[model samples]
Target: MENYKIPDNLAVSEEGFLFLPATGESFTLNEIGKIVIGLLKNGSSIEEIIERLTEEFDVDEHTAEKDVNDFLTQLKNFRLVEEI
Candidate 1:
């Protein structure tokens, strides 16, 4: 699993609203998305995120892994996260 990073110019609210200062773009995240982003901001690896998701949410390991992968893809597509 790779480590991901949230850009320095991006601001994320407690309610999962994301704003990119450079692009003047804003996005709202779902609950799971918010958790994933927070974990990424804390420098958690994908594996760690999966573990946390499984532990914190009512999800199994395989399901959590799949969901996290899908979310990561979305983050990449949105230019919100980078592999580092």
Candidate 2:
């Protein structure tokens, strides 16, 4: 699992709206996305996030890992997170 950092200029609303101060771009996140982003911002490792997801969402480990990986890839593609 890799560590990632959310950009310092990014702002996340309580309702899961993500805004980039640098580019003035905004995006919305689903509930799961919100949780993942929150955990990532808190410095949680990918594995730790998987564990938390499984415990919180009634999802299996495999599903959680896959989902997290996919979400991380999307974040990377969007330039919202950087590998640390």
Error of 1 at 53 (Å): 0.7
lDDT of 2 by residue, 1-84 (tens): 679989888999989999999889899999999999999899999999999999998899999999999988899989999899
Please name the candidate that would achieve the greatest TM-score relative to the true structure. 2
For residues 1-84, write the lDDT of model 1, one tens digit per residue: 677899988899999999988889899999989989998899888899999999998999999998888888888898998779
| Global lDDT of model 2 | 0.93
Report the poorest 10 consecutive residues by lDDT, candidate 2. Answer: 1-10
- Looking at model 1, the pairs that clash are none
What is the Å distance of residue 84 in model 1 from its true position?
A: 0.6
Whole-model lDDT per candidate: 0.90, 0.93
